[model samples]
Target: MSGVNEDYNAISSVYSQISKLPLMVLERQLVAHALSSCKGQTILDLGGGNGIHARKALELGASSVDVVDISSGMLKDGKTITAASGVNPAMIRWFEGDISSTLAHLPLHKSYDVILVGWTFDHAETEDQLLGMWRNVTTYAATGAKLINTRLAYIPKAEETDGIEKYGFLYPDYKEIPGGISYTYEAFTDPPLRCPATSLTNTLDFDESKSIARQHGFRDYQVVDSEQMDVVKEDPAFWRRFVDQP
Candidate 1:
């Protein structure tokens, strides 16, 4: 499930339990691939919840990491976790701001080496709002910067959601909206959490993002195949359903 502002404030701790899921394990592998060459790079993690991926970037040698999200509660949780761990929390800066809008005027650096937008776009409620999130990404990116992001690629039918719960979250109760669709993304944390989300029809194929990035001067956008990932290749059967629906 994507962390969209206030939706996660009360359940932030419950939300972090997603790390124990198999699909999340593979997803982290993808994130590790994106950050593999991020040593010495400055990074911006939009929609970064509790500094999870932000800390990973720090471990991978990021000189600085700025985490921007809309939830003050989640931001507080990040600082708490960092403080408890007693790591270089000073190296990572946390800011409470919305990525769908309001990131440009914030005191953020304009050019980052790598920008990570982890599942933020799916929360866009309209076309303009969705594009607003893209605007933030491009506005802060450097001229040769790489962007590793997750867009809502597909909205599954309720019937197709049968076996996805084991992955820690299941999006059900699909409802068609003006631009695309809306659904409830339920994370199977001990005491579950739900977030109503939207995904645009045009954006479902990922072309909307590619075009936006290109217009902003990015060179390329490639969709990496999970099947080729070593995590999945090692045991395809174990990750079969997730690879199919993820």
Candidate 2:
């Protein structure tokens, strides 16, 4: 299992418990916005935990929502979540594998109108990996389809004066791990013991990310929807208009 597997598998039982949390309200909002154009559209949900976003897309009328995840345990929970919601199994296509492997399963020369990566980039092992993920997404998205994702911000050491700024390929502040930029630090702990740390320099800020998308041949790159989120958002009407492609 990859980092995605370990994290989601650990939370499988408690995943739906988020419905009772305060942030669940906002999460639903974000989810709704992310899937607004689902009706008649094809979608890709990468790192779709518990299939919340995928189910929402189906509800909003997406022709299909393909969920690609690395954890079988997490995929199991996703099935439960969708089933509990009465979603038709035909509406969703679940692939239990890493993103790289899942790419091979997608139809060649076929693409989606909307591709979602909610909080997925932070889980990649390297900058090249992140770039590769982006490349894969673009490969499967129809022209002008939107790519939406989020990442945790970067933080600085406690003794440090200024916190690191978020940039392309930087280590995150919420955890400790090797950064994508040329920064050096002693490893005080080992991987698998803690969440992977992200680099402030190597990570993509909003503008830089859009530019990157454009550089990768994505046109009309823009921020369609964004807000502080603590939980899953379920409203498809919120984001469909801005991010949906013709």
Candidate 3:
């Protein structure tokens, strides 16, 4: 719950409600597009809290998934949900450890076909820690494996709001920290939940991040445009604010 990884032990129960937010539409779209080529493939979901997207991967035709997270509570919650939903719990392996430092020691026996990094990298408090995350990416991912990820890259430090409320979730203004910005990411649900997130500039900077990716054996890094997604094309007016700000 601190430093390179913000353990979500306290808010694990309500965190699943994040999918209820309107912005989740785009997230699902991204996942759908990312997983289009992953049929019968294996996946490694770093920071895959509560198996939300992990289950989505299975639904999208992934053969197996390994969900690594820093929170035991989140893993437990995922297991409970997987068991209750009658989705063979064995399909998803829940491992609790910081993705930044534990990939080598974790029980990841093979390189994956796809690596998921969404809602994962922002917690790094320093550039070295951020590199630690990309390091893990290169570790379990072999050449030709797809790496798909996303985050709130833009920092609305000046404006109070970026018109994101309609898209769901409340991302308040962030304050500058040593090497990043810190803010409470709030999801509006019954008995609301908030996560104190730290997004470093190094993590946000495209040049720097992609530089590290290339240096560490990653290639063909490209940012997918959100405007062209079917979800956005279906309703431009509704998704304007999110796509514009996102």
Question: Candidate 3 regions off by >4 Å?
Answer: 1-7
Q: How many residue pairs clash in each candidate?
A: 0, 31, 1
Q: What Cα-based lDDT does every candidate model obtain?
A: 0.80, 0.60, 0.79
Candidate 1 lDDT score at position 203: 65
Using Cα atoms with residue i matched to residue i, what is each candidate's TM-score against the true structure?
Answer: 0.91, 0.70, 0.91
Candidate 2 wrong stretches, greater than 4 Å: 1-3, 100-102, 105-109, 153-204, 224-246
Candidate 2 structure quality by residue, lDDT tens digits, 26-116:
5466667766766998888877767887888888898888888777777888787787788898788887756644477545337888888
Model 3 per-residue lDDT tens digits across residues 26-77: 8877777777778899999998888877888888788999999998888888
Alpha-carbon error at 62 in model 3, in Å? 1.5
Q: How close is each model in CA RMSD to the real structure? A: 2.4, 8.5, 2.1
Considering summed lDDT, which 10 consecutive residues are worst modelled in model 2?
161-170
lDDT of 2 at 171: 27
